[model samples]
Target: MNDQLLSARDLKVSFDLPGGRQAQAVAGVNLDIAPGEIVALAGESGCGKSTLARTMLALEDATDGSITFGGKSLPKSTKKLRAFRKQVQLVLQDPTGALNPRHTVYDAVAEGLRIHGIEGSNEYDQVISALSQAGLRPPEQYLNRYPYELSGGQRQRVVIAGALALDPQLIIADEPVASLDASVRGEILALFQRLRDDFGLGALVVTHDLGLAWNIADRIAVMYLGRIVEQGPVEQVLLDPQHPYTRALVSVLPDSPVGDPQVLTGEAPDASQIPSGCRFHPRCPLVASGKAAEAGIEEKCRTQDLAVLDADPRNWQSACHYSAQFGRDEVRGTAEPVADSLG
Candidate 1:
């Protein structure tokens, strides 16, 4: 059997806009997670990071492409899909919204087991074990608590425990730490790492925080305007990014010292109005000229979209006109250096 736990190929997700236009939230994205790997998907809001996570969980329909778990294509029938869900689970950004206000922490965590008909004398034991794994100590103390009674971090842990109750092989965590306090976020991240180590759970963590990605992810996939601009081993992509967008992202990270102020300017482009050549040309510092320039090398970036090109044999890939030209020097900015603050 293949060791890959999950594989997504050219996954595309689009939504109908106000008019007749359709916004492509995820466009031809590809990714794979080994049995226990933690792959971080990083990008700003509206970059389709969340949409990608939902698509992977089968929460959203795909416009095209395929997703596979444990060497099997995702089920097409509703019943099969429902059965497939038992093997995959999701943890959202806001745990309060995920848990029912009417349900106690124990009920919330046990819901999956009930639905899967996994009841017995050990059901409560399983629930407690999952809670303990999530660091919700004194599981009995949290058993009767409702969503409102728990702190944000505790509630998030409850949500994670619910996912764990299913004993899923893969977990899609969309901004799992986005709502927690800084102090608690590390504990949660450590919990995820421990879960992976102990239970061999594969996780796809979607977040906008590069620091979080740097701290917990084994690999990093940088997305921009609905496409993966760069991806590779965490150290390779974080310390020596090859794509201009990836370089810019690493430079703006609070832990890294800023190199050039120009790299921080501009924002991601609108999906409907993507630049002619490259979706990120408007914000690309290596384009040779500003957005106003209609001629020269800048025009290439504006008119020519690039494909993901292999940068190394370790599965490192990037999509940029001059990905090979990027290096660590770009992140060594002379601007106001920010302290290594965890967000």
Candidate 2:
């Protein structure tokens, strides 16, 4: 944590909603990305992972808390911020929409360089190197190609190449592989890994896929209802999830070791009208199945609002009140009958 390339402390982002209410998009998130480390922010769609990513990129401002990159607070001046952005690049999902259809691969790759006024006799060389680094081998072959000309994977690589051309230290990829085919998803994920291994590039991959996190991330942070409910090493958190939300997500994975899949009832609550106490209590499997009452934490679970997880980033933490009790038989469904199974 001391050597974190980018860190967000108690970060919060909110937006004005209809009526007099506000949507809490990101609420009190503490995250760190060390040099060369890959951290995946895993969650469902409405959990605010993308908002957190955008906040880190300075595309969205935090309503509270602080964000520091390279051990310094984010710059305020436009000139300074522009320089800061050169070090932190964003790779968005959907390469098709990301790229300019009329632009050639060369143009797409060189666009950032041009924007940052990085022209020189070797600008062309920089584009080629970036393209090659992104795994578009023998880069020259693809330079004249348009976005429509390349396959989905190739188009994604071009998007990555554009980011790499700026020589960024960190990449904040928002669902980078969401639009790709299954075969191409691995290749793109592998490309991200190679970037880290080869260049010591740190990345925060925002995703809803726990499987993707298990495959590519060094650490995983499970986000729910605008907060990180569980976080630790990829194996520790995913294999022995202490938070019910995390457990539910891991259980649905194809290779989940946590017994049967749990079908959480109802949709995620609207951010504008978040539930009191535990924001996830309404959809929590344990609450619906009577396990919480059986364990005598139902009242506390329903009425006590939990704070952020423990401040220590090195240790695994879960915000649930009875996280320690999660080791009980109920997790594996071996105990006597509860009221009903998860919907």
Candidate 3:
């Protein structure tokens, strides 16, 4: 049994602007999330993290590629789509805005149940059960409260409770903790981790915070200009960082004490005018520099496209030609070839 709760293969999403030009928001992304696993999609503001998340949720249409849920391709029939939706849920970035001000907590959580034709005492029990699962104990007390009455964390919990009411198999969260206060962020993240523990639910969180990925995710996928540059186990991607862009993002982390830091320059290239060859080569130090200290591989980087490969099932891989030299910048007073020192 492939046990993959959700998967995307070579997915691309594009938007056509008024000028008849198209912008590819997500470009050739391949990802999968298994039950009880957390995959963090980390990137800058316009790196298409949210776009990819939406495409995975089937909220946004993909211009190219396919999405599969529970080992089957997307359902085209209305009955099948509705059944699929029941198994997959989306948790938006803002909880306060997601909830209705006029509706009580019970009403908000029961909306999904009612939509599926669940009503009467059965609906009430499901609502209370979901609230309790979300850590809102004494669920009856919160049943009548409005969105305004609850704190930010509590409001977010309510949003999660709504999703839980329907017993979804997967939850795709776009910047799930971005809107909450510092104190509340940890609590909400813990809730997500607990969800996996309790029901073996799969979760995919999109965020720009590397630390958050380190704190909660089992795997980390680094994105740049809509393409995934590197992805691997949390320890491998965060500590070893096989790609240059991944290194730049990890270098600035508060606990990263070793390694040389290369500050990124300029803004991410526009999607419509994405540079030729390796999309990240223009700003990558190694791409322009020689293979050795005095030798550069500018020609190779400018004309060739690097494809991601499976290095080992345990360690994640990158789509860079220079994957062999990732940590060499911080050589620690060492020579390129250890045998060279003997000469």
Which candidate number would show the highest lDDT if scored against the true structure?
A: 2
lDDT of 3 by residue, 261-337 (tens): 56887889898877887889877866545442244456656777776443232557777765544443442223122
lDDT of 1: 0.80
Tens digits of per-residue lDDT, candidate 2, 278-299, equal 8899999878988888889888
Clashing pairs in 3: 289-296, 290-295, 290-296, 291-295
lDDT of each: 0.80, 0.87, 0.81
Candidate 1: tens digits of C-alpha lDDT, residues 87-135: 8888889988999999999999999999888978889999999999888
Worst 10 residues of 2 by lDDT: 334-343
TM-score of the candidate numbered 2?
A: 0.94
Once model 2 is optimally superposed onto the true structure by TM-score, how far is the C-alpha of residue 128 displaced, in angstroms? 0.6
lDDT of 2 at 185: 95
Candidate with the greatest TM-score versus the true structure: 2
Off by over 4 Å in 2: 325-343
Which scores higher on lDDT, 1 or 3? 3
Model 1 CA lDDT for position 162 = 94
User: How does candidate 3 score on lDDT?
Assistant: 0.81
List the candidates' TM-scores in order: 0.89, 0.94, 0.91
Please state the error at residue 62 of candidate 1 in Å.
Answer: 1.2
